[model samples]
Target: MELTSGWADPEPMAEGGIAGLSPYLQDRLEREAIPKSGKDALPPEQDRLLDQLLSAAFRE
Candidate 1:
C-alpha cells in the first residue's frame, strides 16, 4: 500500500503536444504565448507591408 501526492507531474511543452503541430502554427502559438507591447503584436504580413510602404515613402 502506498500514498501518492495529489498533484500530477507537469508535462513538458517541447516534446509532444505543440510539437505535433505544423511549424507555421507552432510559430504562431509561440508568438501568441509571449506578451508584446505597442506595435510588436502586428502579424508578419502586416509588418512586411508596412515596411514596404515605409521604404516607398522614403524613395519618393
Candidate 2:
C-alpha cells in the first residue's frame, strides 16, 4: 500500500532534554523507543487498530 501522507508529526524534544542522559541511555532510547525514517512496520497492536479504523470508516 502506498501511504502518500497523514504521517503524524513526532513530538519535538525539549531543548537540552537528552543532553544530560548517559550515553548508554541515549543509545537505548534511539534504538528502541524513538522513531526513525524508513521504518515502515508498525507494532502488531497498532496495525490492528489501524485496520479497525479503516474498516469502520469504509463500512456501509
TM-score of 1: 0.26
Candidate 2 lDDT over residue span 1-54, tens digit each: 988889689665322234223456456667787633223433235566579769
Task: Output the lDDT of residue 14, model 2.
Answer: 21
Candidate 2 deviant stretches above 4 angstroms:
1-44
Whole-model lDDT values for every prediction? 0.52, 0.51
TM-score for every candidate vs. truth?
A: 0.26, 0.26
Superposed Cα deviation of residue 19, candidate 2 (Å): 28
In model 1, state the lDDT of residue 42: 36
